[model samples]
Target: MGRKYLTLASALLLALCLNACGSRPGTVPPPSGGGEGEGSPLLTPASPDDCYWTAVRHESYNPSFDRTEVSTMPTEKWWADLYLNEDGTALFREVLGFGYASYLINVEWWLGADNVLRLTGEDYDGELVTMDGRMEKDRSVMLETPYGDRFYFEPAQKPDSGGALCIADLEGTWRMTGGEPGAGEKHMASLLNIERRWSDGEEGGYILRAEYYSARLLDTDTPQYETQKELLVEKREEALSDGFSGEPWSARLFSEESGAEYLAALTERNTLHLRRSDAPDGPQTVYTRSDSFLPETLTLTLADEPDDALIFYWRDPPAEVAQPLEALPMTALEKGGQNRILLVGRWYETDIQFCTGSAEQNADGTLGEWITDTVLYEGTLGIDEPQWFSLSIPEKNARLCLFMKRPWDESWFTWPITDQDPFLVSGNTFLTET
Candidate 1:
C-alpha cells in the first residue's frame, strides 16, 4: 500500500497517520539485497532499492450479517520506505491514515562513527526530519529510530522479469491445512487470499488479504480471535523460506495491528509456509491452494429496463462476506402482473423467497412493499445434499417439492419482484394488507 504514516502537526494528522499507516516491530529480515539488508545493508545499500511499509489498523466488511470486522494488526507501529541511491542521496516517506496525508522527504544519509546509521531529510514544507538508528544484534532489523519504531527493508524486485512466480500466480484462496497441536478441535485454519483487483487509484494489480491471530491473542488460546489484514502487495521477495530454495515470490506479512511478522514463502508449488523469521523452526502455519470462494449468484433483472438486482446464495450458510453490488431496482416496474424479474441462482433452495408488489411511494419518501399473491412465493433454504422439500406458496402443494438441485444458475427472468427481506406469514395465510 502506497499509504504512509503522516502525523505532521495536528490531531487531524494524528488521526490520519493512525489510519493511513502502521508498522510491526518483529525480527523478520528486511527485504533487501537477496535477504537481510545487513550486508548490502540498510545502513548502506550500494544500489538503489525500493521498500513498501505500513503502520496500520483496519476492518473488513461482512455483508452476510451486515457486520464490520475490526482488527489491530500485530505489526510495527512505525516504519518507512527508503530509497538509497548510489550518490548518497535518498528519499524517505511514510504515509499516515489513508494516504490522504504524508511525510515525504529527500535526504543525504551516512553511517556514524559508532556504527550508527543516520539520515537527514527535508520535507516539502522545508522542515528537516532527522532519523538515526543502530543495527540490532542480528543486523536483520534497525531498532532505534526517531519514531521509536524498528525498521526493515524489502526487495523491490519484481518476479515478472526473473521468470519466477508472476502476479497472476498468486490469485486464489489458500487455507492453512492444519492447526498447531493442542490448539483445538475447531479445525482452526488461517486464510490467505490473493485476488487481482482493479480500482481508479490502484489501476489494476493484486490485493492480498490474510487472517491470523496475534501472538497476544494466540497466547490467550483464542484461535477464534481473528486479525484480518488487507495489504497492497506487488512483486516483492521478502526472504527465502527457511527450507525453500531460490527466491520465492513473497509478500511482506507485517501486522501493525498485531505486532508480528511472518515470512511466507512457497515451500512447494501449491504449498505455502508462513514461517516466523525469528524462530525459523518455531510452530509455523502452512497453506494449500484452493479455488476462490464465489457465492452462488441469483440475478433479478428487469424484464425491460436495464435495472438489475441480485440475491446471493451462500453455500457456507451465513457466509461471512458480502460482495458489493449496485442497489437492487425496486422501482423498475409498473402495476403489471407479468413484469417480473427472473428469480434464480445455482439455487440451493428450490423454493427461494419470491416477493412481488405494485411499485408505490411511502409516506416517508421511501419505497416499501408487501408480499404479492402472484403464483410464485414459495421459498426454501438449504444444505448441499440432494434433498426434496414440499413447495408451499399460494396454499400448499405437497406434490411440488425441491429435487436434488445442482448446476447452480438461471437462464431468463420470470418472477417480477423488488428485492426485500424474508417475509412473515401467519397460518400460511397470505397477507392482503397494503
Candidate 2:
C-alpha cells in the first residue's frame, strides 16, 4: 500500500487508442440517475451498540497451520520495542526507506469473554493508502487498518510494558462493499457501522464519529498491442513505469468529463482534505511522518495461545529501480467456486484502470453488469519495498478497492493530515471462542 516517485525535471507523452469488441475501449459513463447523492449525512455520534461483543468459538482451535511450517517459525518483536527507542536490533535498519516487506500481521478474531475482539498490527508496505477500505479513528467501534493494514483490540489497561494495547475505536458510517482500482492494481471492500463515544481520560481515550460511503473502483486496462510497432513498444514500457525508470514522479495528468465526489476529510493526525462538491474550497491532502508513508513498527512476543493468526514481524523496504508494472498471474484469476466481488482495479482521472470483473447478482436488487478484463499498470504503486498480493474472495459479502490516482508532493506537508498506506487484507472471518 505504498509507492512514490517524484522530484521531476521534465516529461510528456500521451497517446491512447484501442478498439476492441466494438465500442468498449476505456468506457467511463455510468452515473446518470439524478443529482443529489452524497447527502445522506447524519450518524456520526459513534454507534454500533457502543461496542458489544459475544462472538466466541474455541473448540480446542487449530485452523490449519503449516503454511510451510508457519513459514519457518519465530515471531513477536513487540512493535519494535514500542516504536524503536534503544536502536532495538536496528528495527530493520531504521526502516530502510520504507518500501515494505513486513513488520506486522497479527489478526486474531473471537469475541465473548466479556467481549474482546482483537487486531494486532499492520503497515504492509506503503502508498498513502485509503480509497475507503476504512481508517480514521484516533473511536467508535474500533478500527486501525486502513493504511497500516489492520489493528484493533478491545480489552485494554494492560500496557505497562506488559501486553495487549490497541484501541482506535472506529467512528462509523462506511459503505462501499467491494472494489478494484485501475490500470496498475488496487483493492477495496468496506462496510463500517460505528458510533461509540466516551472520552475523558483513561478508559483508553474514546471518541468515535462513524459514517461511511466509498466505492472507489477505478480501472485502466492495458495490453492490446499487436501492431503499430507493438504499440510503440508498449508506450516505451509505460514510460519506464512512470518514474522514467530512474525513479522520478512528481506527476500530474488531468482530464475531466465532469464527474467528481471528493470529500475525504479526516481533519487531523496524519491529516487529509479533498472536498469537491461539498466544497469549502476543496483540494488539500496532507500526511507527514515519512519513510515513504509509515509502517516500520514490529513487536512480537506471544504464547498466551489466543494470538490465533500470525506473521508477527517483517522487513524489506530499500530496493528500487525495477519499474514497468503489469503482472497478473494467479492463473489469470478465476479460482474454484464462490468468493465474489472481483474487479481488480480502477481510477479514471489521472489515468488508472486495471478493470477485470465477475460480479454476480440477479434478483430484484439489480446489479449485474461487470464482466470485464482490462489491464494497464505501468508505474508508482507501493514505492520501494512492499510487494505482496493475495485474493480468494469466496464471497460472504465482500468488497475491496484502494486507489489514489492524482496528487503527491510530500502531500503538501500535512495540512490537516491523513496519509496512510500499509495494507493487508485478510478474510475467512475467523474468530472462534465457541
Candidate 3:
C-alpha cells in the first residue's frame, strides 16, 4: 500500500510539469532570440539601442451603464513615438486628441534588464503617471495597463537627416495680431513685434526680442503711440520627447528684470502660441510668420467713431422751443461717464416722455431692447420741462436709446414720425476715448 501511494504522488507531479510546459491560449512566449540558448542573437543583458525609431498605437474602451455592455469599437486612440539610446534612456512623445483640441505629452523612459520599459517622468501639468511594458524580439514592445488596455510599439522609419525645424526658421521677424478689443476700436491698439537672433556658433538657440506697442485707435499720427514695452526671450528647442507627428519645440521666455517666466509653444509650422505657463487657461497670444520688419517709429490716427445719427439725445428742456442747451458730443461719453438729455424741438408741443435704454439689432434687422435703470422724464413743452435730465452710460461700447411716447391724439405730428415706432434713435453713437 505504501508503494501504491508513492506512485500516485509521482504521477500527479508529472501531470503538473506537463501543464506548465504547454502554451496558454493568448499568452505570448518570450522571444527565443533574446533568452539564453544555443544561437541567441541578443546579449544576456538585452540592449535596446538598435531599436532607433518606435511607433506606438493604443486603444481605449469605455463600458456602458450595464457594465456587461462594452461597445466593440474603441472609444479613443492614442499615438506616440520613441527614440531609444544605448544608455538605457529613451525619449517619448505622445499626441492625444481630446474633443476639438490636441494635447502633447513628453516624458523620459528607462529600460531595465528583464525587458522592462518604465516611464519615469511627468508632463507639463506636473502630473506624473508611470507605466511598465515588456520589450519583444528587439523589434516590438507590448505594454498592458492594470485596466487591461494594451499599447503596441513597432519599429518605425527613421526621420530625415536634416532637422525637422531649425532656429533659422524662427529667426528674423514675426507679426502678432488678434486680441480683446479688436482692430480699429477706441481701445488702445496693440502692436506686437517679435525678433529672433541666433548665437554665433549655436544652431538651435535664439535670442528672442519682443516689443509691445499701445497706439491710439485708428490713428496714423506718431503721437498715438503711447507706451512701449520690451522683453528679451531666451529661445531653445526643448527635447521633451521624440518627434511623433511633428517636432516638439518650446521656448522659455524670462524677463531678467522681473524674473518672470513665460511659456511659448511652436503650435504649427509657422505659428506660435504664448502665455504664462502658470495660468494655463488664461488668454493666449498668437504669433504668425511675417516678412515685415519691425517699425522704428509708430504713428497714431483718429479711430473711426460711431455715426452721429445713431447718438440719442432728448431735446433739452422738453420745450416747444428749438435751441440747444449744451452740445452732447461723443467724446463726452467717457468709459463710464454720464450725459444729460434735454428734449428740444418745434414738435415738442405735446407732453414729451422719453426714457434712455439699450437695444440689440438682430440678424434680421429687427431691434431687441435691453432696458436698464429705466427713468421716465415727462413734461409738457415749455411747461413742466425739467431744468436738467441725464442718461447714465455704463460702458464705452454701450448702445443707448431715447424712447418717446406714442402719439395718442392725431393732432401730434413730427417729421419721420410713425405710430408703430416709439424710438427716437439708438446706436453706439458715443465717442470712445483711448
Candidate 4:
C-alpha cells in the first residue's frame, strides 16, 4: 500500500472516531467486541457463507535483511474491516479518522482452485493493493503480502440489521461507539451523549440535545470553551432514499451556540450521521445506540454580566460609579408599570423576574440573583460572538441600541424604554430570556 494513500484514509476516517482510548503507540492490541479467541488460531478452511473477517493480527517481514522478519510488529490501526459476499464482491472499509468517518473501497475477490482466496482493492489515493490468502480446511483465511506480511482473520459478529427506520426507532439515547477522538487539529466537538425525544417540546415537534467535546482536549490548541451543545433537532417532512441502504429519515439540528443548523440522516444499523448543512462534504460525526456511555467534563465560565448587559443613564454617574442602579428589593418590583421582567440589581420597566438562578455564586455558597444596568434585546443570536455576561439584543432591534453596540466607545446615550428589555417603545413585546 502507498504511504500517502494510507495516511489520507487514516486521517479523514478516524478523525471523528469516539472513545479514542489507546494503550501505547506502535503496539497493535487484540481486536475486541466481535471476534472469538485471539492469536494464531488453529488452521481450518474458510466457510462458504458470506461474512466479514476482522483483521486480528497484522504482521510483516522485510526480505532485505539477511534474516527476514515476519510480523516484526503489527501496526495499530483502529479499523481494517474486510467484507466478503458469496457473489464474489468485497468491501474493504478502512476507518482511520478516530471514528469520524469511514471510507469503503470496492474490492473483487474469488476463491480459486485449492481454496486460494484472491482479493484486490484500492486505497484512498487509488493505489492498487493485491493479496492472496490460503484457506485451511475452509475454516480460516490467512492473507499474505509482498513483504511477507500476514493478516489473521476471524468472522466478525455482525450486528442484526433491519430495513427502514422511523423516528420512534431512534428516539432513545445514542452513544458514540468508535475509537476515541484523539487530540488532533480536526477533533472539534465530537458527540459524547445524545437524547432524541420525538416531541416538539409541546408534544408535536422533535428535540435532540447531546453532550459534545466527549474527547478530552489533549491537544493544547483545542478551540472553544463550552463542552456541551444544546441542539434542537427536528425531523424534516421529506424522506430521502439512500442507495447504499434503503429509505431513510432526515432531520435538521439547530445549535444556539453556533446559531447554525445541521442535517441528520438515519437508516439501518442503528447509526445516525450528522453533517453541517452548509458544508455537506466537510467533516461529519456518527452515533449509535448507547451502550456504555463515555464520561465528559464540563467547564463553565460565568461572565460578570450578560453579553448584552449595559449601563447607560441620561446623566453619567460619578466617575468612580458606585452602584450604577439601586438594588431594588423584591417588594419594590411592584412599583414598576405593567410589571414587566424584574432585575434584582438592575433597572427594569415593570420590575419582572426575567429569569431565575444565581447570577454569580455567593461567598457563603448561597444563591443571589443580579444583572447589569440593563440588557439589550438582540433580535437574533450568533451575530457577534455573544458573551455570557453581555446582554443579547436581537439583530433586528440592533439599530435601536446602536449606541450600546460600540464596545470601544466609553460614553453613550441611554435608549431607556426604546432599547432595553421588554421594550416600552416597541410595537411588539419581547419574551424574557429563559
For residue 357, model 1's alpha carbon misses the true position, in angstroms, by 25
lDDT of each candidate versus the true structure:
0.37, 0.22, 0.40, 0.40
TM-score of each: 0.30, 0.16, 0.30, 0.29
| Candidate 1: residue 114 lDDT (0-100) | 31
Off by over 4 Å in 1: 1-164, 182-186, 198-223, 234-240, 245-249, 255-260, 276-279, 295-434
* Candidate 2 lDDT over residue span 7-43, tens digit each: 1110000000001001121242212332221222122
Residues 1-434, candidate 1, lDDT per residue (tens digit)?
22222212222322222122221113212222232222221222212222222223334457798876654532332233454444545555443211212243466655332334466777535677776654322222242344444445443442232233333444455666753743344334355665444333433222454443322222232323344455444345544444455344665556666666666666444666566657756776777775433223311211222212222222211222222111111112223222222222322343353443343445774433333444333444332211111122322211111111222645222222223222222211111112
Badly placed stretches (over 4 Å) of model 4 are 1-50, 61-77, 97-104, 145-148, 162-263, 266-434
**TM-score of predicted model 3?**
0.30
Better of 2 and 3 by TM-score: 3
lDDT for position 268 in model 1: 47
- Stretches of model 2 off by over 4 angstroms after superposition: 1-294, 297-332, 336-382, 385-388, 391-434
Candidate 1 whole-model C-alpha lDDT, 0 to 1:
0.37
Stretch of 10 with least lDDT, candidate 2:
226-235
Q: How many residue pairs clash in each candidate?
A: 50, 102, 14, 54
Candidate 4 TM-score over all chains jointly = 0.29
